[model samples]
Target chain A: MVEVKLFASLRTVAGEKGFLTDAASVGELLREAAERYGEDFAKRLQIATVLVNGKNIAHLRWKRTRLKDGDVVSLFPPLAGG
Target chain B: MIGGYMGKVLQVDLSTGAIESYSLPERMLELYVGNKGLGARLLYDLLPPMTDPLSEKNVFIVTTAPLTGAGAPSSNRFNITTKSPLTGAIVNSNCGGNFGVFLKRAGYDSLIITGKASKPVYLKINEEGVSIEDASELWGLDTEKIQEKLTAGTGKLVIGPAGENLVKYAAVFSQERAAGRGGVGAVMGSKNLKAVIAGGKKRVPVAHKDKFKDACRKWRQLSREHPATGEELPRFGTSIFVNKCNATHTLPTRNFLHGSYDEADAVSGETLAEKHLIKNIGCYGCPIACGRQVQLHGKNIKGPEYETVGLFGPNLMNADLKAIIELNYQADLLGMDTISLGNTLGFVMEAREKGLIKTDLAFGKIDRLSRTLDDIAYRRGLGDDMAEGVRFLSQKYGGEEFALHVKGMELASYEPRGAVGQGLGYAIGSRGGCHIAAGYPIYLEANGPITVDPLATTGKPGLVVLNQTTMEAVSTIGCCIFSVYMFLPKALLELNARSPLISKIVRSTFLYGGNIIGKALSWPAWTLPVPAPFFMLPQVQTHAHCTGERYTLGKMMELGKRVVSMDRIFNLREGLTGADDTLPKRLTDELQRAEEPRSKVTLSKMLPKYYNFRGWTPAGVPREKTLRTLQIEEEPMLPQTAMGAASTV
Candidate 1:
């Protein structure tokens, strides 16, 4: 099972904070998270930056980047001010 | 002897078309100091208790300090101070260019404008004299076109339709740079004024010229040596902070609902320099050429700053750098503040999300974004509502909870979710939600000697006050805040290298010289500490000591507090109560910590402590004793309170 944590405005759609999901690809994990939540979950998901464990997905293949069972994915939206 | 200042003030009344000149008062210069402080004092004195912002009675002032035009390093900035149509408080916005220098050379330290012009006109000041010229032909001309049409390469401060229409957040533009924020241009437009074109060949006289030269050398050297100032800012421009800020989760995106971005790399300064920048531009005598003349397609234009990049780019969910450049250009031409425009647009997008204003205004609709900008500036249909800015929009619609503004002014690029104290600063900031007005907790959150995790709430309120007060002084001096990154300590050092005359003055007056002279003069307790002449240092030797006055961290922090409290008092007199000073509900509640473990803003945990540190009442009104301590006159209109009553008074 993969653990994905949602933060900022994205958490509003994710319904809960972190959830355990059995998924193979990063795309699949997000899709499942959306299915379990609502359609707004997918639409609201664009704002967040995804991190596998502690490493950013930007270092890899972006959203298409694969995920593994027991892997941790953290999602955070952009913050503002000075 | 800071080099940038013209050491003069120009007062003009449009009602009779009369002009008056005055040498900046020595006491005022010593007490209130540069642009921001001088502005605070001038406006506070010149304006009455309940003056309407748009009335002929209001004064529109543009002020620069002694360090402004002086070949002083980074003294190439000036501020516009006026009553804001948006918030009806004191609003001062700074712009960097040759304008301040030109105005200074024209024999003015500041320009105080009152009354309304009978017709649309632009004020032209040359070596010959000042005249109010008909701007009927120049009206509606874009900033670049106006500059091109001017006879000489004079400094021109001009407004556009938005300002003319009194859009409230309209800005004044010159050479693509803007006196951004606080609707100064709107105030100017309300006065029926169009532009001010000024230039002069006269050299500004320096006090202790020899020591001034030495300070100039040192300041230049120090600026060149500093990593961010010398390298990053010069090479990549202010947009360089984009990637770094994103990495740290401080970048504002998606109407500040999110704190991270996907295509952050596309908008990074490094990317812009590599892809678009054609040449570097510098303001007056500044060594750091952070301004980039970017070439896109066949047109060359000033590139967007970090705030612009974040606002029009990722905040709208469009990461196209070229589009942002064009958007910035469009906004500039329209005389709209890019920050407020972007913020208002973001609010609209969020409204769309909440099923409020449905017109294809979604996250990544670039075409809609462009149309929306035009619509807002022109105040057409839904655009009219957006032009009122987010606060007005939220009120008109039904999402005050998600409205991303503090005091009507839209928040700047940096969002508060990642930096909690910044949120508090924005909430309590006197001039609505301004970052520079008091960028407190921000320094602590990002790059202070004492670092706090962005998510942390402790130590922020004190830090916020500290930032506000110090920034108040710096802006008052009319110097760029970037100097803080380079010469916070070295600016205070007093080793005389060259320029003997200036050296004596620096040693005798600036470098704790007041104490030495005061002791010698038998006035032990009355020695005044002069701000270090950071801008006046010789370019080559400035690295040995950064220019501008530098003080111990404690002293600097105290200055920040002083400015913050003074501004608070001004707001209190203006009828701002604690109820009006607060953060949006989402930031205080819905926005969660991403970096810090289980941390939220926890504003309730910080406000009381901040109030105590400020010596204000629990309700956040500045106490009469605090006002007395600051030497502020008691406001007669303050409601009388019954002893031990509910304290509603």
Candidate 2:
């Protein structure tokens, strides 16, 4: 099982902090999230950043990066402030 | 006269008790615009070189932009510009409050004050006239009480005991908002001025009313559609960055010794909204409503912003959110700047830990904070030293190595070790360790959604210039800095998320193409005269309509560059050389994490390139040609007697 976290507007759309997913890859996990949360969440997710274990996936293997059991994934929408 | 301008500047000489009003030169208005930009020009022209900031020689200006009181969203901002008592640099501190609106309504665009008052006094301005009234009774009052004591219908700018006592980081308060940085209030105290009240029924006119109205409507719509502005900011406020900054390791912890905090969530905006917030507040004409109104000690007060939370929270190793809230309120009531106040406390805590000073304050200790804040305002004992800010403390207490400041002013809450470009910004920022002045590169480096490598130093010079120029322009026009959030629209964010290839391209453009972009943009305004699309930034169109002047993106960017250059020239004349453009040893020499060898900021690698791109000499002075191209003239030295008057006062 993987723990997924949502932040800022992503959290607002998700209607909860996050959920547990059993998906094996980041792409699969995101797909599951989209299906469960509906279109608004999916649209927000489209602009959201995905981080695996505190590392931005863009620096890693994008969505193709594989995930393992007990891994934590966090999603954040574009945010700005001083 | 421009449609947005009141066409007059009020000049007051406290020493002589003389008040004069002069028409603003149309040429000067066209060249410098207003507020921060025009104020810089005025300060440069009026101030003698190296005048003591706390002395009567220092010129103090309160200025408004054309957009201010022109019915533009979040445009009711006024700027306080003067030589900083803390940093000895030119400081232009802007505040979002009703004072600017009412000041414009009272038939003036700016107020120029000079000389020391014979005694404590306050100035009251109305459609009828302006007067310098005795304020002896109002001298010791706190910010909240003084405004209430003043006439109800007028808008006020008041100082508290902190300013009266001349705390280096004392702030000028207007309503719940503050022009808080660089000890602007200390300058006011030096003048023995208590408050300035403005009230009138005059309306700010627009040049092309129909066009201006249409632009404003579209601008509001654009703001509403942007996710960052319309949703995230409105719902969560700026404190929402706590969790994100923590996750990104950009949250300053333990006086910037580390970047991550264990208890960040306790002070997060989510927690504030969920448990403490009574309602959301906003500045005049602001649609985002990003301000927080939270219940503290049975009273509803302005909640702590992100910087306050970080500095008072993780930076001091304290986790009590309640303590932070209360301290935030106490600091504001005392007319102290929370950013500087929190940083000072963090420095003292670290100083205590290292045996650099003998203080009872300890890291993570909460009980004495409220009393300590009071002590600072009154300049009592150790609080007196603390009131002098980190620069003085470091000099006297032998902790300069760990002093988390730049050029005298303390750093804001964003720890630069996690975002190295921000480190560069802090070091070279004109008004000391100001994040806004430094252009806030941490957004692109770490906190923003699509980011460059936080530890990378290669493309930062160019990126820093871009952000700095853009933000300077935005501030000059009296808009909230938050309005810049829409620069990266929802479509770009969506594209960044949807395609890794696109993200790579975007990130690469910033990381590698920064120099090319910066250099190209550094060209003369005539080379790029076209205005960017309204959707990209409605400010250009709104400005054009309001002033009935042709404004383009190039002109806007050029104005920003000129403003920055003008400030640099002023600082240079005041003896602030490139040598002073430096960060503390903590940021430069110490790595945040032991294992991450590249975690520290390598400022030397970026500063030279930044200067070159800015068309400045290697010593960081703007080149003659650069100034000429930007149409900035060398400010003439005004004689002492003529300081507060163009004609007479």
TM-score of every prediction relative to native: 0.78, 0.97
Candidate 1 colliding pairs, count: 46
**Highest-DockQ candidate:** 2
Assess each model's interface with DockQ, reporting 2 decimals per model: 0.02, 0.65
Per-residue lDDT tens digits of candidate 2, residues B1-649? 6779998888888888788887766777887888899899889888778899999878899999999999988678999999999999999999987899999899999999988898999999998999999999999999999999999988899999999999999999999999999999999999999999999999998999999999999999999998888888888888988988898788999888888998997888878877788998988778888999999768889998899999999998888888899999889989999999888998899888898999889888999999999999999999999899999999999889888888898899898999999999998889989999999998888888879888999899999999999889888988889988878877888787776788888899998998887887789888887886787678878888999989888889998898999899999999999999898888899888898899899888999999998899999989999999988887553344445353332
Clashing pairs in 2: none
A1, model 1: CA deviation in Å? 19
DockQ of 2: 0.65
Q: Chain A TM-score, candidate 1?
A: 0.79
Q: Which candidate should be chosen as best, given TM-score against the real structure?
A: 2
Interface RMSD in angstroms for candidate 2: 1.4
Residues B1-649, candidate 1, lDDT per residue (tens digit)? 3333455667777877876565654545554556776677667666666678888877788877667776678776888887788887778888886787788777777887888888888898876888888888887776677777775768878888888888879998766789889898889888889889888887766555666677776667777865456655777777765654565566778887777687887887767877798988866667787788887678887888877898897788888888998888888888989888888888888898889887778888888777877787778888887777888888888789878777778888876777777887888887888778645556446422112445655556655654565566566556677666543332222222122343344323322231232122221112324433444222212211222333433333333444566666666767778877777787777745455553346778667766766667899976776655544453322112211011110
